[model samples]
Target chain A: MLTYIVEDDPVAAYLAELMIRKEQFCSEVQSYVNGQRAFDSLKEANETGGALPDVILLDLNMPLMDGWDFLDAFDSLAIAKDVCVFVVTSSIRPDDIEKTTHYKHVRGFFSKPIDEKALKRMQHLLEVPNN
Target chain B: MRTPDYLQAELLDLAVADATLFNFLHGTVLDGLWYWDLQAPENGWVNSKLWLTLGHDAQHLPPEPNAWQAALLPADFATMQQVVAAKAADAACHTFSQVLRFHRLDGSEVWMDCRALLLRNEAGTATRLVGALLNITREVEKEAYAVEIANHYSTILSNQSVYIIKTDAAGNYTYVNDLFYERFGYDAQIIGTSSLNSIIEEDRPKCLDVVAQCFVEPEVPHQVILRKPYNNGPVKSNHWEFKGLVDEQGQVTEILCVGYDVTLLTENLQKSQHLLEVTKQQNLRLQNFAYIISHNIRSHSANLTSLAKLLDGNGNADQKAIFLQMLNTSTAKLAETIANLNDIVTINTQGAIAKEPRLLKEEIIKTLDALNVQIRQHQIRVEVDVPADLLVPVVPAYLDSILLNLLSNAVKYRATERPAFIRLYTYQEPGFIVLAVQDNGLGIDLNRNRNKVFGMYKTFHNNDDARGMGLFISKNQVEAMQGRIEIESQTDVGSTFKVFFSTNVDVDLYS
Candidate 1:
């Protein structure tokens, strides 16, 4: 399975990419500093004949198109159905938790810096087949 | 001068006629007469015609000698008895008279002006007494009616709230009602002796001047401003309307002045002036905030747009990679600025207060750890003298953001000549926790820009990292928590920032 990390903070984003690659959380890892370019790649992957990334780690605080706004626009694109999105944010606000849980495409909410424990948990969940 | 029997009888009749002749010589007055014989007391004759007009009958009256005394009111009985006893003491007395009540057969009473003529023989012994009574009821009723009306007028004058001052033609206060006395803190007995001038000397001169103008011009009311000292040691102002009183001879004898208090009007005017000043300052702040948002956001957005265009156009592989990297960095920076602006917007739109508890020591330690690399690079000395138990009652995110901004600014703007020395301390002041953040950095010229340091987008130093949003956001967060931020700084020396947080937070007072 392929994994993607989308975050605006270069330091935090690279850290997330390193954690996933080291833990073998997925077969391959790709990093994007913003949501728009990452979303364009996901759309192109759907049109071509290849398996989509099994998991996408989306950072909420970003430029032009934030995570929430990107998710709203991505739902209309109808790229793939099996892929899961995880909202990763530094904000520990209660309102953010309440908001991300309502989205059907979102699997979980995680705080930064994404540690090895969360990467292993994701690896285990992604290995399980959907009913 | 006794003549023959027939002549003597005629002379006696003439003498009696002359004595009673004054009755027919009437004037335009309400006086009637009566007569009584002491030897034959039942033969008393009251003013029969006057009593008849008051619905009385003379024939059916009591036959007792002093039956008329029943007509006297119970209150006047004792006085009438005294007068009668004095008259009957000496029978040889020539004159006996008393103003007594005459009860007619119809059970009606009338006041009578009575006078008596005594008839005495050669031994100076009284044989009979002839008395006369005049009806003076009309004059008594008129006088009593006048007094009742005056009493009603006084009742109205005393109950009124406004100050009623009646002055003679000379503008001297003849009557100051009870309201005037109580309101001006004067004695009720000061009605006539002391004038309005004595009590309110400051306002009196102007009031008298206005009255003089009214006197000069009849029917024209003079309005004057009367400012006088109250018991509270403040000069209370009033608006007085002076209505002059003039006699039929066209001479102004007194002034009827009515004054109303206008202190509230003056206070409202001052409040409106203060509101105008505050509104002007807010307008200026809004203008500066808009300018900051436009200039800062546009700068990053333009850089990103141009770099993207350069990468998309013709370039070598290395140059393209470099342009692409530059574009991504610029876009990320733009996103960060937008995020900060969104935070500001969120804080501004909230209609209620926040309920976020932040541990002061935890937040400070986290911010220092985040800037640990910079600390090592600068070889800076960090002295955190805050009490370990101190916890600020604030929203967690905002508290972190405020302290982070202040600490970063201190480290980033250090003086070039000296090694950076930053100190953080907290102590209890009179009403708040005084949190001091001191840095031996390039101190600000506070005198030149004292009031504008916390203002939106105001930067003094030429540091590239000073976008000016940090202090502004910090200030907003501090004010939102009902705390105040003050700064003491001098150029080349150091800067000390004191944040005062009230200790009255009920959720966690000091835990």
Candidate 2:
């Protein structure tokens, strides 16, 4: 499986990459510093019939473009595969978590530093059948 | 043409005996008659009709000067003595008339219309004073009852502690009651003058309309709110009700007005409305502060948590070094946010901030001097349209901080394509001094980022120095001084920030 980490902080992105590699959760992982760059990559890959990531880690607060803006643009595209998106933010606001329910592709919401237990839950979700 | 012998003899006797005719005049034609011979005070006569109505023997009774004292009411006698008899009995002033009260044999009252004519001798002195008295008891009683009713209503209108004014159809003051004179510091001098002059200039038109309506629709009452300017105190406001008073012929003759002072009620309502608006704005601000404080601290701490976990685990020496450095940066950011929070809280917890009058031009000079380095680097031209000694009441530190932020912001966001110019202006509002700063620079995307422009840690331009805390702190400081700030801008167009300082202490930002 391929995964993408769309976050602004380089250290946070590096930590996620290292943890995923250690767990062997995916075959390969890529990183984008902001929502804008990630959205451009997704759009280009969709147009070219390139490989699409199966999972996406999105951050809510970012410069240039935020996670909400990216989601708003992402909904306009037509893709054949189901790509599970997880929102991650340091904000303790219940409203931000509640907002994620509005997007169909959004699977879960987590606080910063995706933990071991949370990763295990994701792995279990992947094992489960779509039905 | 042919008359009976008896009727002819009766007519002939009326012509031959004039004394008998006079006796008939005294008996039936006149109600009562008296003749006082001033030349001979003892020689006086009172006709029988004069005393017969009182059930007394008065057939040719000798009428002395004090003969009627027992019958006349003492009060009415005193008034008659002062008025009807005041004029000397001479050829020039011979006649006198009055309504006098007397008593009957049953001790009941009787009102008499007494008409007296003086008969003067060759020496021009009073000799015979002939007075004819007619019983006017019913007419006087009706008049007295009408006066009693009028007095009852007058007492009610006067003692109610309100303004009662009567004006002619021309709006001239015919009357203003005692309460109006005592409470509002006016006098009878207002009489015969236009009532519109007493109303403040701005409220004159409304008052005129009310009075005109009173004339046009005399039955329908009209109301108006008028402000009265005082000589020694603040202007007072009153709610006035005007109604037209019509004469017996159904023509509007005068305007009757009643007024109640509403200055305190109006001021309290305004204060309450202003307080409500301020409270709502403060609540909204508190919510923003809560959300920002939560987000800012958590962002830094979340980075620290990640760095700490990576450092604790088994990692290469190089990786530990990288995580350690990130941890340092995160801690620094957290400390900065805490400091900013302290500044914001200080604004609320502090008492009334001390203010001083400073020249607006001098303040601009000081702020410009501080931003001189940035101005030179950007090659920006600054224009000042403020007076040399325009005074502004503001806290010194707050003014300096606000100016530094706005002036620096102008230079910091300069557009490179054209020559950059900034304008500083000052003007007067009703009770405020407005300092406007206009810039030709890389204007903010107001449509997209208006809400977030003053938010903590919200950086739109991604500049190295864009901490985004400047505007938030400036806003808080401005509010602390009981002043306000407003912005007008469009995307790609320049922005003008207007900061208003209250010239009066009683003035409120919301008001």
Leading candidate by TM-score: 2
Q: Per-residue lDDT of B161-184 in model 1, one digit per residue for the tens?
A: 577878777655677777777767
Full-model lDDT, candidate 1 = 0.70
The runs of at least 3 residues in candidate 2 whose Cα sits more than 4 Å from the true structure, single-residue gaps closed, are: A1-33, A47-57, A73-131, B1-68, B73-99, B103-109, B114-134, B147-275, B297-335, B348-352, B357-394, B402-450, B461-466, B478-511
Docking class of 1: incorrect
Pairs of residues clashing in candidate 1 = A63-B335, B32-B134, B32-B135, B33-B133, B34-B133, B113-B134, B168-B253, B168-B254, B169-B253, B169-B254
lDDT by residue for model 2 (B188-296), tens = 8889999888788988888888888988899677998899875446898899999999999999999999998899988998899888988888888787678778877
* Reference-based TM-score of each model: 0.49, 0.58
> Which stretches of candidate 1 lie above 4 Å from their native place?
A1-131, B1-13, B17-47, B52-133, B152-160, B164-181, B184-229, B232-237, B240-258, B264-338, B346-403, B423-436, B444-452, B455-467, B478-493, B498-511
A45-99 per-residue lDDT for model 1 (tens digits): 7888665777899987554356876788778777655888888775555667799
Clashing pairs for predicted structure model 2, backbone only: none
In model 1, the Cα lDDT at residue B244 comes to 74
- Give the interface RMSD of candidate 2: 2.0
Best by DockQ: 2
